[model samples]
Target: METQSMLVVPVGEETEFNVYVSTQWPTLIQEAVAETLDIQSSRVTCHVKRLGGAFGGKVIKTSILASITSVAAWKTNRAVRCVLERGEDMLITGGRHPVLGKYKVGFMTDGRIVAADFHYYANAGCFVDESVLISEKILLHLDNAYNIPNLRGFSVACRTNLPSNTAFRGFGVPQGVLVVENMINDVAMALGCPADQIREINMYTGPSVTHYKFEFSPDNLQRCWEECKLKSEYGIRREAVDQFNQHNRWKKRGISIIPIKYGIAFAEGFLNQAAALVHIYKDGSVLVSHGGTEMGQGIHTKMQQIASRELHIPTTKIYISETSTNTVPNTCPSAASFGTDANGMAVKNACEILYQRLEPIRLKNPTGSWESWVKEAFFEKISLSSTGFYRGHDLYMDWDKMKGQPYSYFTFGVCCSEVELDCLTGDYRTVRTDIVVDIGRSLNPSVDIGQIEGAFTQGLGLYTLEELKYSPTGLLYTRGPSQYKIPAVCDMPLQFNVYLLSDSNNPHAIYSSKGIGEPTLFLGSSIFFAIKDAVAAARSDSGLMGPFTFDSPATPERACLACSSPFIQKIPASQPGSFTAWALDI
Candidate 1:
């Protein structure tokens, strides 16, 4: 309940509902709208040129809005467009789930977590939209990157009056990861050592199994931690932080390094399929249409690269079509950080089929240009169009048993954050952040790095700045930008460094590239731990020598109270069920 008063609401962009209905399934916007409106699917044509920014907000809600618009259009016999203002959008659309977690962990003196019992209650709003799946994800990811032997966890999707909470970047993984990280921090505080030491001691390096019984292969968990530690000079910085804390009374410095091993696939299992259509013209130009929608994640760019590489054609010669159900049927949402993995492989498959068709022609004329080869294939009446369907081959999960591989692979990364906290004001600034990620032969370093930076910054906002508030009667109070705070450029780390792991490749993915989206967002937990470290320093200065627990957003008020000895004294030691008191004794 410590975080209840923080009242931090999710600060996502206000995405408007925009759709055009025409007679169709191959078009982008019409199929889902048509189905929802109970109209002939072929009679509805949907055109989705592009999204402003979805971040998982537009997947289902857009369909809901489009259905409403279609009905209006049908009834009025005129065009209908519904756009919610910023305030209206905030009130109507769901954001990330507000989670409440209670956990008990038993760790050794060296800070190795041996067992954990955790329960997470997610505010699913008024409906069961994605909350059940989100809960499953939380349970699966409770261990984060650690290998805990005896762990039992479950989640409850509480129905509330608020709008239904939908998916964000990391889905529900961030909230789950936060709980385990907090426990690790508590353990470190209890053992009087750096949090990083405990993290390293318990990381999944060798053969390990999750609570759900999915086993891990030898992975880059240790590599990422060690590389981040060396690259960030964590040892040197810890010394500096200690010296700085000793010299300063009101301002304290703290550093923390956190690692993540996020699984890559849809938890639902059935949504792990994609289709792509490829067309090759006589002029050697190629067009690709895939089931995955592009919401500013560079998926199209990656697909283009995949097609170009697979066909041995220049990327400039490839054009990616807008996502439409007519082109690729029964598509999955572009989520779970599998946009590139699912769609890219489908495109690769389509291109490979084209290559096989043209192989005999190329063998006949060994030195022909690509255009000439395409014309020859046309003359030979070989099919120049191919549609590829790909279902993730080995993905299986028994939800009742909660035992199977839900993810095709796992993405690994580490983040080290340095923050300076002002005890007087509870204000904090990110001094610097160094990140080392295993992108597994990054398809495009620039695009992947941009995603890493953006996701990390958004996660930082979630943990430290953004706070959604509501009235007692269930009305949104922080409904607009003026009331909701998002991290700006000024809030960025004064110094930032990001690196992609080389010499690592995903054997299971197309071009051996791993997912780069959601994994890095979990890295933002480092900042939260860093803030906690500063608060711990302040408490140490005040001669309080046990673990300290502070809810997130770590607002100036919370930081000030965490540092105040008078505040600690005022808290009754005998108070039952007091988390603060319990933390002090732990």
Candidate 2:
């Protein structure tokens, strides 16, 4: 008997954790602090910087990066940079968990949803991290504004051979929302309904009822749809698409209007917690530090606005500091679009407390020396501190029974999209998108609009044009700019529409300002459906509409296979298998 060479397998060996992580922890930014020390508000500057682009990349994952870097820096006793290569980044980074969703939606022919059942299967890679949270968001937004009598929705987590995924743009809402929204599109198509017409009939367009104790606002979705349809030229575009598809028999086009009813604050009310410290110097300058990190979403800028509003000081007198544990301790991750909502409140409240102490001094010496006013106010004041948390309101919840209103308030809107596809190469383009959102009010419209556009574009890439490759050894092959694909300037749609509800502010939000972060990404799912419609039309298949839903980051090759060329290729469907289709050929 010939002795075969013995093969050795390593056991329990933790490979060097070549991990690159991100976090939304830093609220009191040092840059904001330094600026406040200089000219403060006259220039109205915010010291902001970002480590990367796209979703989960800027959220809680930064905590991992910080922790790892801290450990390396401590051990080396020198500046140690542990930047993982692209493959390592992909292997270690969390992403949009591909989801499988099934729903049975029942509605009266008039458009009121009476009964519905939602089943969500989330692919939690290697661990149950954000799956449950995403599911909660899914349940919260179920029926999406419509008052439904009997509704049951459940989510399950499935372990797979992949990296543990975390929050992306919409926290966990996008994954769950895509599943529900897709069902809506299918239902409309089955019933021969127009997208906008169906939304008018079903969405929470009626008088609002608070699900939990949080005040529910009755923002008009019906009006929003009308404004967007006309502004976006949705009807005209639809007709044009039909004509284009008719002339070009080889390719087709499709359009869809989707509604997103995202809730504000963290999924867990405790996650809504925030802390801040506001300091007023003898020079009348203020230092503001709170628990929220700025990754170019203008959080620091908004916090300044919050402080100014509360303190009655010019935007120039305030300075925000770096988000270090030393400033505001045990902070929540800034992924829930609540950076300003939570930390800004804490900052503003802190300033108000400080100002109340100074009020007597300022009034007493209307003509007194500025130095004297400072001396009296600083010495007589108690330590200045304020903390705010969005713990669920008890008046709205049956705590023991877990039955009642859960969200503080609902942020409602609908996105309409039109797209064209190529028959020869299975490529597609987003010709236009119209988004109508009720953001309550924009403390800064420029910043809010930028977030909306940025998030939407990133989501478009996730669902329509991005892909991550993995080796059988549980390694990701695609990483960094060279290998990974993101949207560029040329990929933007020809027509874009963004409308913010002008007269309203979120009653429960800090100062009535609503969050426009994560919801921006979920709207891209609307575009994905439109593209899916175009593909289906080109393929001319009706049965494919029911179940064959594709997960996103849909690169050209994947899109081709998903839309056309269903090559009868058999992949070894089993656990402990490399999830790379391209490698299978090798």
Candidate 3:
């Protein structure tokens, strides 16, 4: 996490506001500032250079600071700056929504999920801020790459008296996916079969249709699954884990494989659009500005490449200045992993327009250099600037009918994780991890790989390491790094391997590439399931069997308690007339 800062200066004849902030939604900041100051929306212009780190926090929370700073500048007629300290940010800003899932699943002897009924309640905190959208996302992704025939579910964001929870990296999809995964784990335990067996048998293969009516033929998710299994030597590792469990009493090892089929788009249909402005100078150099913000995700680089490809120029000649409301107005937040998909197309369209204008000049001198053709075109008085726009097609949803396609496309991947646990102390370390994803002809292999690695590590923190604590009075106790826990250097796996599936093509996006930002994130649940597997081994040694319930954020205390032993069962109960019983079950 990094400090979020913004500066506002009141200037110009019409009392215009020029704001500089690191935010994903500059238009939103402009609108909020204008409204707070009771001025015209056009009176405010937001300039976004880049964000140190947002993930999703700045999509909405950033407007609060921008509005406050704008108000101060308006009152004093001087520049004002607002910066949030790390500790202050944590105390005021909310994290991922805490989910309480209730579910009942029915399966066959061979591990096919026949029917599932789920009711998920998400804590929305003191106010409703995009919680309904989050709840809708949870319902949309209830069947995570699996084929559940009879599925019925409802999700609601319950109100609470606390800080409002906001958007995170995976939005609500990861939480929803975890529900079905936990059910599969329980079913495997009940049948004394491997969880991967259940996953394979229930996976969507060949031609399948989702509950929301999105159809897929020749889905690449199956290929990713098989390829991950082959590359990870899954069968051999399973046997090794069994042997390790048999030989060791105090230490246990476990392994798990999880698949992902994530939809790529904003649930709100109108938000799935982008606009760009491209200006080609007389010297043959290009400047590109798009609605997407750059937060170290390489969106600008991808836009540069797109422009270069469309204009038949070297990448060195293309420049992406900054995302500003003055250029592209009313842009959606650079979120939902669609920044590249939506903005790349807009940039390409603008470049194509300029390319067509210069085509006749190029044909006049077939062997001429690009600079010569541009010079001729400039002499011919051809326009060198263009504005482009793109909106998602056939993307709509009607919640009343529970139908329509809300996603533009799906991104698929698989991950296999292995972990060794100290049953005595509940400490664990990741031994090895293997991942395979279908990014569909990567735009930049290095950037995509970094995204996959960083997302998985963040998900690792969400699923196993990070824990939020609250007192009985609803005060947050884990309000800073000293009290909270996140993944660190020592938490990484000793051996890690990542591979991109070949021959995968996505026709819906630019350059046949799919969104890879959020797909690999849910794969981090493999680590959580692996920890459960290790605890299951310890339970079996104590003669405990059958299915058991386990919650997320498998912290050390929970992991130690999950390894139920004879000693734990032998603890004596308090006397009938003893002092007041302990309040908590622990």
Candidate 4:
């Protein structure tokens, strides 16, 4: 659910407004507000103190709030503030698109995918918004972490009356990845081998090209898998789970490992630029402003660190200003996990210019205090302020042709999940999870780990507990916390271990660090596969053969249906409402 809570207040009777919105694309909101109010773009000021959480919802929707509030202020001739309650917010804001996918895959007996064809329909709701872009992203990620020789994918944005679905963390990539991962699981079941083995056999290697024709170099996909396997003791745990399932008829244990290779950068190449302004005061203190927003992702912290490192100044001497269009104009939204890579480079460029200005003063007074040198530079009327801009070079994509390098690089990861399932109740618990992620010389280990954990948790909720339901008339029923269930603290695995691949680095990014925001969410699919493994165990115990197929969420009811044999009769039509009660008899 990519929804955000926002507050907007007009400044005064003047056409200008002091708009406070929680959004990643504040400049876009500012421009929209100005245009809506028939005022110059300069009259609209958007101040984003910080966002509690955005995922991706706060970008375009915040502009709508800004426009409404500005109009209200104009009509009333007074300041107006609008803050939506949670229920209202949920009803109005969009979430991840509910996609219906149809896929046909051809595989060998050894579990290698020879070809795949996928047709995806995204529920775009009432408005187009970003649905077309999201659909393109879904097509781009249909291959997920594997390499298939022949692949064809197409996507459609299906318009409905509900609120328009917008971007989530991974945008539409997760939906596409889920389809392929599910197919791989089916292939593994048919081959009578673990899904991880199939994934390994199909994993991309040297000189491989994606469906979009992006060539790959050596990546950490295999490395992360091997490291995660060793750390999780996957083989030993599988043996133990088999033994437990053999002895325990009512309870079964299952384990699965999955890998992910997510491309970084916006598929739309124009959004790959960033700007930063750095001001050095006479007192040797610096203030840095960048286009990236801070949604608890530590992007501001990384910008400050970049400026400090580049200027050869202590971090304490640097302060990050609020993200404002007045300071850094025509900015791209902080998204696609490129916030650090893009903004960090811009800040670095600004700091380098400032450094050049101070170099002469430093050489003249090499032993002087830092403050004295800054004072000398200030006295000489040297420009202590500099604006830096960076555009990602050599990044090109042809949407019409749908071929070229859409990403600067890729982020890779692997996850292993172990689960215990109750055959009678269809209840399950995640026993353990192991993860190895390649963050490419992590800018900040703590922040990267936090992102990985948070994204994984959200993804787990999406697949296991976060079920969004709607009424017949297009009303959302799961509009509140009570109706919608997200993963709680207890839902975390009992034994969880996460490791960063230290030897990896992205040659194309700032500080050689890859984006860590959305890739780990794909790892959460491991839990779903693990649950499927448990259901397969139950099916095998009942003398059922062949592949087991079930829908998402693997809810208790769905799990029970997957476990029961074909001969096991379900509740009759008269007692259909009591299906769960009778399902225990299986």
lDDT of 2 by residue, 128-242 (tens): 7676666666666665655666777777777887788766667567777676666666666666666556566666645665333333545556666676777777888888877
Worst 10 residues of 3 by lDDT: 577-586
lDDT (0-100) at residue 442 of candidate 1?
A: 88
Clashing residue pairs found in predicted model 3:
none
Query: Would you list the rank order by lDDT, best first?
Result: 3, 4, 1, 2
lDDT by residue (tens digit), candidate 4, 49-157 = 7788888888788788868877887777666767777788888877898888888989998888999999999999899989998898888888888889899999999
Instruction: List the global CA lDDT of all models.
Output: 0.79, 0.64, 0.89, 0.84
Q: Write down the TM-score of every candidate.
A: 0.91, 0.80, 0.97, 0.95
TM-score ranking of the models = 3, 4, 1, 2
Candidate maximizing lDDT: 3
**Stretches > 4 Å off in candidate 2:** 1-22, 26-54, 57-81, 105-115, 145-149, 208-218, 367-402, 540-586
**Prediction RMSDs, each to the true structure:** 6.8, 9.8, 2.2, 3.2
Score candidate 4 by lDDT.
0.84
Predicted candidate 3 versus true structure: per-residue lDDT over 1-586, tens digit per residue? 6667899999976989999998989999999999999999898999998889788889888898888888899889999988888777876768788888889999899888999998999988888887888898999989988899999999999998778888889998888889889988999999999999999999998888999887885368889999999999999999999999999988899999999889898867888889999998888898999999999899999999899899999999999889999999989899999999999989988999999999899888989988888888889999999999897655888888888788988999899999999887789999999999999989999999999999999889988988877765677777788989989999998999999999998898988998988888898999999999999999999998978887888887778778876666676756876865332121
Tell me the deviation in Å of residue 90 in model 2: 2.0
Summed backbone clashes in each candidate are 12, 23, 0, 0
Which stretches of candidate 1 lie above 4 Å from their native place? 1-32, 565-586
Give me candidate 4's TM-score against the actual structure.
0.95
Q: In TM-score terms, which candidate is top?
A: 3
Q: List the residue pairs that clash in candidate 4.
A: none
